[model samples]
Each structure stands twice: as C-alpha cells, then as structure tokens.
Target: MELDRISNLENDITQKIFSYLSIKEAARTSVLSKNWSHKWIVPPCLVFDDENGLSTETIVSHVLLLHNGPIDSFKLSSRKDLDPNDIDQWIHYLSINSIKEIIVKKRNRYSSSYSISSNLFSCQDLTHLELYNCLLQPPSTLKGFGMLKSLHIRRVTVTRDVLEEVISHSPLLEKIILCKLGIRHLKIDAPNVSFLELRGGFEDVELENTINLVEVSIDQKRGSTNSSSLLKFFFKLPRIERLTLQDSFLEGANGSLPKKLPEPCLCLNFLSISIRLNNLEDISTAMCLLRSSPALQELEISVQQDQHVADAAEVTGWLNDKQNRPFTQLRILKVTGFSCVKAEMDFIVFLLLSSPALQQLEISFGRKAVEVVDFSWIYDNQNNGAFMQLRLVKVTGLSGSKAQANFIRILLSSTSTTLERLTLQPAASAKELWELFKLLGEFINRVSVPAVVLEFLDPSNSVQESDDSSSSSDSDDDIGF
Candidate 1:
C-alpha cells in the first residue's frame, strides 16, 4: 500500500513549486517520502531570501551543491549581516552556471560598495539583468551578451562613458530604464531601441539614432536649471508615437523655450498632454504645437490657469482657418478642471460649431463661479438649414441653480430629435427629480422627431438609506425626465 501511495504522489507532483524558505528548509522536503528525495535537485528557478540569518557563504555553497544544470532564473536579496565577499562568490558561481536572468538586491544599513566584476559581463546567456543599490565598475563592452534584450539599473552611479559603451554594444537592445544615475550628458546611438524611460535630475540626453522608437517617458523631478538643453532634446524626437513629460520644473518664465514649439509632425492618432502655462505668452506657444496636429480624433486638455480662456478665440480661428482645417473626424472632446467662464464657454461653442461631426461633448466645471451658458444656438441654427451632428450631452456635478437648469432646458428644447441621450446629475430630492424627468419626457413626446431619452440621476447615491426609507432609490427613479 505504501509503494502504491508513493507512485501516486510522484504523479501528483507534475507542476512547478515556488518557495521562499532557506536552502536548509527546502532540502528537508526530500524527507517527505522516497518520491520527494530528488525534488529539490531540478527546480527550474531558485530564489533565496536571507531572512533567517543565513550567511552568504553558506547560501552560496548550498546553491552550488544543489544546482547542476543551467538555471532559468536566480534572485537573491539579502538584508541581514553578511560578508560582501560571500555575496560576490554567489554571483560568480551563478554566472558560471549560465544563468539566463539574475536580480541582486542588497539592503545594508551602512552604505557598502558591491562591484559587478567583469565575469558578469561575459555571461553569454544573460538576457535580463537588474541591480538595485549596487556599484558597478565600468564595463569595457556589453558584447559578451549577444542576446541581451533588457537592462535596468536604478540608484547606482553609472558614468556617461560606461553607459555609452554598454548601449553601443547591445545591437538588439529594445528597452533601457535608468533612474538616478547622475548622468549629466546622455547620448544614445542605438538604432533599434523601441522604448526608453529616463528619470532623475535633468540630463542633456540626445537621441539622434533611435529611428524605430515608439514611446519615450521622461520624468524630471530634480528641478534642474538646465531647461533649454532639455527642451532642445525633446523637440528632436523625430517619429515617437507616444511622449509623456511629467514634473518638469522649467515653467516658461525661467527663460526656457516655450513648451509647445518645435512640434514633431508625427503620425500620432492619440495625444494626452499637460502644460504649465503661466501666461498668455506660454499659451500662444502651446497653440503653435496644437495647430501642428490637424488629424487628432480625441483630445483631453488640462489647463493650469483660467486666464488661458481668452486665447480660445485664436485657437478656434486656428482650427477653422481654411489653411488649417478643423478636425472634422473628431468624435470625443473633454475639458476638465477649468472654470467655464465666458471665454472658455465661447471657445467650446467655437469647437461645437466647427466640428460638424462631433458626437460627445463633456465639460467639467471647476467651481460655481461662472454661470452655465445655453448653447441652443447650435441646434436652432441647425433647424435653419445648419449642419450640426451632436448626439449626446453630459453635465456632471450639477449644482441646483437656475443657470444650470436653464442650460438643460435649452439643450432639450433645441436638439429634441438629434439629441438621443442627455445625462444630468442634480443635487435635488427624488420627487423634484421625478418632476423634471416627467417634464422633459412630455416635451420630447410632443416633438415630431424621435422621443429623446433623458436620464436624471441623483448626485448623491452613497448616503445609504434603507430601500423602504428611500423612495427615490427604487427602479421608478429611472423615469424619463
């Protein structure tokens, strides 16, 4: 009966196992039964976290004794007290055994320097290497790893010359992520790099040869004074499909070039951008960039000031100019976190009038300072042989006021047939909401066009009253407005 059970256990252990125990604890699994004696010999991957005060030398010796084949991956992160030599020995042993991927993390209270020896660079099978808070001597060349694809170095000091050498050697390299490397001048010549992420202090990075690049993300959090150098580098990105700029301290006043100039005429179909325009001068610079792209279908703009609204007329004129035709293919337009003042409202009206094919329009008001404007002229003009094609209008976070209510009434009155959906969330009682929905429904039924579907949603639904106590929370609350 025991022999049959052992055979059954062997058949049951077909899947791989991942464990976080010390090597000694892992070896004890051999004593579970005869079928498990050699279970620890051929783990596809080995991960050892020094949690139980295991010495690095002891761990390295145990790993050498157990690992006989090429390891698919090896990860070692030690925080306890251990000799640096022992850690170096473990890395050396793993490199000799042809480890394909390796991650080494050292967290000592005192700052210690752990250098990656030249032997590490000679690992021909290594495809991925990640190091955290470790020191690396300048690599002569990364030519040893002929198949290297991804390399990440964070919180380390890599000189510019060494960085250039490594990038020059990796012919098939696709992705490189660098953080806090203290690199002052970065020059990349790799022709096949597809993705590159650079963060830390402002460094003058030149990407003159990445022809097949698709995405680039730069985070400049160090508030460096070198704004012109960075802006020059940003404008030189030739064909990048996606670009993201975050936490840049070069607000236009500091003599930095306008953030919007030198725009790349990329075949970009989607764009999400945030600009810190402190004045109209900066806004004009940004408008120059917006005018460069006439094919954008979806646009999300988050402005930092309310005064930029005055530039809306110029923006609208730029869009409708015969030379710069409007984005006739635009379907969705969203503007958030700006007071819908008269200038902003007029800009939106301009877009609505220009974009004859727009289907959805969403404008989020920042505060209750400005009164909501009624854009019924768009629909009324359409009735007089105008060619407006709007279908849905949504106004969120509605304050119970006359201006907002009148805006809703004007929209319902204007586009009764073409306006198929209207979503309103008002801060009012359920009975008040029911009355508004009924009124709107009757108005739509009287029209010869299709009866528009008007939906009135209570702005507050999370107060948690009992179903019986809350008459407005019932299915009847969905009645047409």
Candidate 2:
C-alpha cells in the first residue's frame, strides 16, 4: 500500500505515526489529505528545531494552542537569540500539561540567556529533564521531583542552594550530571541515584543518604586537602561497582585512609584512575584506593605529567619493600599517558610480576615518553622461560624509539605464547606514524601471532574503549553525567 493508505489508518494510529516525524515534517502532512490537516496538532512527542527554519517560540506557542492531549515528551532547540520570558511561558504550558520529559538546548554561542520557569518545579510527572546554557532559579515552594529519573545540567547558572533543593526534591532520580557550573559544594541526599558524574570546578561533593549508587565518576583538581570530602563519599558507597577517578580523588585518600582501612569494597570490579605517579604522596594515594578494592578485575591507570617529584630513592625503596597484597583477581591492565620514565616502567613490571592471573596488558605511550627510554631491558634480561597467561596485548600511542621497538618485539616473542591478537596504533601526530610502521616492520617478521589487526586512528578518532565500556552498566541509558 502507498503512504497515503498507511496514513488512512485510525486517527490514534496516525497520530502515533506522526509522533515519529519532526514537527515540520508532520505539519507538511497536511498536504496529503484533509484528514491529515489536524493530525499534526496532537502528537504526543513534539520537537521544534529552530535551526530548521521554524521559530521555536512561535511553533511551541502554536502547538500549545492546538495540542489537545498530554505531552509525553517535548524538545525545543534554538540557535537564534531568545527571550527568557518566552521560554518561561513555554515551560509553564508544559508543566500544566503534565509533560513527561523536557529537553531544551540553546545552540548558538550568541543566543540570549534563558532562565527556566519556576513553574517547572511543579512538574511531578517529569521523568527526564535536560537543560544546556540556561539559568535555573528553583522556586522556594518546591516540594520534590517525585517521578524524575534523570537530570543533566551543563553550562547553566544555578546557585548552590537551588541545585541542592532541586536534587533533594528528586526522590526517584537515578542519574545526575553536573558540569561547568560554578557551585562550590554539592550535597546530594537522593536515595535512588545509582549513576553520578561530577566534573568541572567544584570544591566539594557531600554524599548524604544516596546508598544504592553503583558507579561514580569524578573529574576535578587534585590535592591532599580534598581527601576529607572524598572519604565521606567513598565511605557511603559500599555497593559501588565501577569508579573512575582523577588524581585529585587519590589525593584525598592519601593522608586519610583509616588505620583499619574501611572495609574492602567487595562489589567494586573495575577501577580507572588518572595519577601523577612521580609524587610519593600520589603513588601512595593510588595504592590506598587499590588496597580497598580487593575484587577489582580490570585496572586502568592514566599516568599524567605533573611538576611535583618525590624522592625517587624513597619511592623505589617503598616499591621494593612494600608488602602490599596482590590483586589476585586482576586480569587486564591498561596504562595510558605513559612517559616511559623509570617509575612508570617499574610500575608496569610490578603489575606483571604481581598479577599471577594476568591475561592482557595494554600500554600507550605519550609523545614525550616515546623519546625518554631505552626499553631494551623490558624483556632482554629475563631468561626465565616462564609462560604468562596473557591472551591479548595492545600497545597504542607508539612513537619512534629503538628501545620501544625492541620492547614490543621482545614482549611478543618472550611472553604469553598463547597471545591471540596484537593491536598496535601510532601516536596522533603524523611525525610519529612512521615510528609505528618501523616497529611493525620488525614485529611482522618475527612475532608469533595468529592474527594481526591493524587499526589506524587519528587523534580525533582515538578513544579508549575501556572508558566507553561504562555503557555496559545498567545506568548507561541515563544522560551523560
């Protein structure tokens, strides 16, 4: 049957069909037949894109005037300047209609400021709410967001009290993302929030009664003084499964691990942390978190560059003498931002020797680190023909270095004869591309691999798959927070 035949279905079915089309596309359906003239006015899902040459304000106003049913979801985007009051009126209309989800995006850099309407606080039916570059001054009479499930606030101006009030009211809220906002302290008491991501410059985040949380991501500045707040957050989350932390998070734990070391985080199976390992305090900080996560199976460490350098003599001495417990469950290790410094190399060697069940090692070299070392020692001196359990090896960000080349060759030749696949990629810069091929030339001739899959990724295309693996978590469908 033709589209017209399809459109001739029952009115409710036609309305459902129209819901899948853009507002403009649905409006154009009026030309199909007189039966379709009013069909576009009652779509449960309405989206207005001003960039498509439809005036968001006029379209939303017109839709509100003609819309005869509850709005299940409404999204409006404006690339042109807008009046804050206009947006307020639109929000007021949606609130009264019991809108289920609202997404407002201001795309133009020069767009006028838009402040969220106070009426939005009364939206009890809203399940998902997202706002970008808007101002939010939550009403004082706000009771709570009893049905809200996800909230994402980015580049918005919201005061600390308003933020706290909004969150406190959201009882069913499962995920929240706060980014690029100028709030200093964040205190969340939401009981059901499972996935939380906090970035930008916030001085502290205090977790009150949010007990069911499973995953947490914190990207912020680093220092020992921040440990007190982190301790409060970590101590509250006994059920956390996956945690990604920047060096700043480690700084907080560096000086404050309880003498009894809060109970081992038995549920935590994955951990990713960025650390400036040159400092003894930072190394110990990382160790502090590691010791607490006894069940961690996958560990990702991004070795960042920083100015502070602890006494190497003390760091090495501790590494050699420290009787730290091994990560017996650990199977995969990925290290990025590697600078090929002695400490970093030592750390990799430590993990290899310590992890008895280790199966895979992924090492990515940073630009500066590629030229720093003669890595011939990586496997050259080891005569123990001990077979490793490793099945996969991936080395990224390879820049030209004879030592690095030799290390790759020796690693493949000596360790884990059962290794299934080897993945190698060059550094982002074109200058470093040749270095990768130079090493690949030697490896292709001597390595014993069943299959070699060469993947060439430019800087923009480069992304750590492990970082994206968080999508496998249950809360992955929640907005990016």
Clash totals for all candidate models: 2, 3
Per residue, candidate 1 scores C-alpha lDDT tens digits across 1-481 of 3356543554225224434445567677778767667766656577766665766558667767776555777776666545657666766777778778887765542456576665677677778777666667755445535667778776666678777877777777788877667777888877778888776664587886788777676655424535446656555556766554444333322455543455644554444444433334434444454455555566554434433343444543443453334666667776554343434443455556656677886654343334446444344333332224668877655544444444455555555657777776653332244555555566667765554566666667513222111112212112211
- Model 2: per-residue Cα lDDT over 274-338, one tens digit each: 77677777677677777788888999987777666666556667776654567788898988777
**Model-by-model lDDT, in order?**
0.57, 0.72
Cα misplacement distance, residue 113 of candidate 2 (Å): 4.3
Report the number of backbone clashes for model 2.
Answer: 3
CA shift of 441, model 1, Å: 12
TM-score of 1: 0.62
Off by over 4 Å in 2: 1-42, 66-68, 107-113, 222-227, 251-253, 258-260, 310-314, 367-370, 373-387, 431-444, 447-461, 464-481
lDDT of 2: 0.72
